[model samples]
Target: MTTLTGTERKNITPGLSVSIVLKKDQRSGKLTDGVVKDILTKAPNHTHGIKVRLQTGEIGRVKVIKTGIV
Candidate 1:
């Protein structure tokens, strides 16, 4: 179970479980876990993190990619 840093777009995909930092929670550096529903970031990589929309409709930049889980 190798986890990815979640800063690269190539590491993220639909259905993958990930921890994200929502815009509102950015100040607190909080993490919200959910399954990825869509890849929102167009770039290959980002300084902050790759933004994505979770299955539950929450949107944020990825902080950690939870490998081996869906």
Candidate 2:
């Protein structure tokens, strides 16, 4: 399966499945998976990743955009 990076804001949308790294988890590179609830990044893209809020209310910078499923 092919995976997409989450550095661009346009590549992400609400209700999409994604993996994100919370602020506290950045050092550990831990990924939190969830459906996107909101797009928090204002720019077209971010060098790190686009910030988002998951359905579960967790906010983080997107790391992976899981495709082929919603």
Q: Which candidate gets the maximum TM-score versus the true structure?
A: 2
lDDT string for model 1 (23-49, tens) is: 999999999999999999999999899
Model 1 regions lying over 4 Å from their true place: none
On a 0 to 100 scale, what is the lDDT of residue 25 in model 1? Answer: 100
Clashes of each: 0, 0
TM-score of 1: 0.92
Candidate 1 clash total? 0
Prediction 2 global C-alpha lDDT:
0.95
Q: What C-alpha lDDT do the candidate models reach, one value each? A: 0.94, 0.95
Put down candidate 2 lDDT per residue, 22-69, tens digits, no spaces. 999999999999999999999999999999999999999999999985
State every prediction's TM-score relative to the real structure: 0.92, 0.94
